[model samples]
Target: MTAATVLVVALGEVRSPVLESVTLARTLGTPVLLSLQPLSEADTDALGRAGVARALVADLGEARHAPAVAGRAVATAAEATGATVVLLPTSFVAKEAAAHAAFLLDAGLLVDVATLRLESGELVGGKRVFAGTWETECAVTSPVAVATVRANAIVAADAPEAVTTAVEPLSVDATLPRGLVLDEHEEHPRAEGRPALAEAAVVVAGGRGTEGDFAAVEELADALGAAIGTTRDCVDEGWQPHDAQIGQTGVTIAPRLYIGAGISGAPHHHGGMQASGTIVAVNVDPDAPLVQIADLAVIGDLQEILPAAAQAIREHRES
Candidate 1:
């Protein structure tokens, strides 16, 4: 119950879980900062403003993310601070690094933790089990516990006092994993500039009824500062990327708000976003399955309703 320090892996810009992780650390102990190798000044400032007690900028030089190298960087920071707990955002990069860090430090790793608390000096975590239908509690007995927290799952309140954070540089000397050199990269343009689907607080999803056109969906999503999603049919028709598909066979998301447009609310698709806090369905069919579960159901032509809704929201926000 008496953790000396909690090391938090900073997600840098677009950090969805920073406040949540900071709050979690505050409940258990103090938070120390660590970023991916070759840390940026913006990320350092972000950590300092969030009231981190101290930061360890890992200088990995050229071998930035050579699997074990990332783990070694984090492990070194944890050891230096004598950290009892390590909290990281449930992001793709952080999750990958956490897996390796757990092995290197021999810590108990908990992934997708939605809730955690410190009771009698014991860290108890709650996570989803059996396809997000059931909740399971987990507790670690190891000296160092590593937990990856889901985004937007915790409430972050502002601290009462202004904290003066200190930054310390810790250079890590790690050998790259053999045969894991970086290959050439190819960057392609995306349809819209929106947040990652899983991490977004709001999501606007379309289905087969979109008719190969996602203008309305994208517009509404962008207006609400939300992410875009699609059904399996839309992806199959090449209207959206496979990463945007939300169904039983695709990615699962639990945002604060979910808007389903031109969707029938199939069982498979519902399984993906059933955990959403609020659902708003816009469909032509009055009896669409999505309408049954939605908090607000709009029965109309999506082509007309979507644009009008987006415009109204834009105007309201501007006003």
Candidate 2:
């Protein structure tokens, strides 16, 4: 069947991809949002502001992992709503759930999709391949399509008005695979009170030149309301967590603005963020490879450069 309703599966807060997916759905049909957990008041308000048609939640209920439970919940919601297309944010958790949902529905699945649309009653997507060296278009021929969309690939637009949300509980079979049991689990100490790296409009990243200090980079990121990232070298040196690393081995990002400080722009690193709308490189070496790809380059010491930039932004915002 042609896609007539879109089911957006979200883990926590409504990500930029959800908004974009809704926007695309509006062009084709109706859009409804489904969450794994109950939406907070703030999250509900944000969704209303973004103008989603309906909102529903399904508790994971004592689960080994979020994806396994959440995926079945999504399938149940889709069946209840008659949604023919399911859109998930491309986070690790969401991707896992999307994969599970595809298997359950026997639907075609796509990941890291940069664009989506309906052509001749089929869902078509465009994605980056070959380490960002090529773009490929693919279409889903199955009755239902499930896809995980990249964050920040599309601009979000406000809707005319907020719709009254309808909430429902979904039933999911939670039999664990291989009877896996949690022996022990501890959450990592992630950065707090800051924008999430994947959804941030701006990002300030440090590299080996940081020399085990991130004070300057953090200050700059705070000034710009940006997220912080670091190179793999910094992660290996225990200066930053592995989650903060940006490269082929780490998370891929496509922000409106990306600023690199003391980075040499290795291929692995550049391949992850080369799709950024704007790139700025700051390094003492004018011959750095990062400078060649940057829209703007500042040759100077990071100690002097970062502080000055933060102060300038502060003064500009105040004025």
All candidates: TM-score: 0.88, 0.93
Indicate the TM-score of model 1. Answer: 0.88
Alpha-carbon deviation at 148 in model 1, angstroms: 0.5
The whole-model lDDT of each prediction reads 0.80, 0.82
Where is the poorest 10-residue window by lDDT in model 1? 182-191
Lowest lDDT 10-residue stretch of candidate 2 = 181-190
Pairs of residues at least 3 apart in sequence or in different chains that clash in candidate 2: none
Residue 14, model 1: lDDT of: 20
Q: Go through the candidates in order and give the clash count of each.
A: 1, 0
Candidate 2, residues 181-277, lDDT tens digits: the string is: 6455465554665667776779999999989889999999989989999888899999999888898899788889999999999998998788788
Model 2 lDDT, residue 295, Cα: 99
Error of 1 at 308 (Å): 1.8
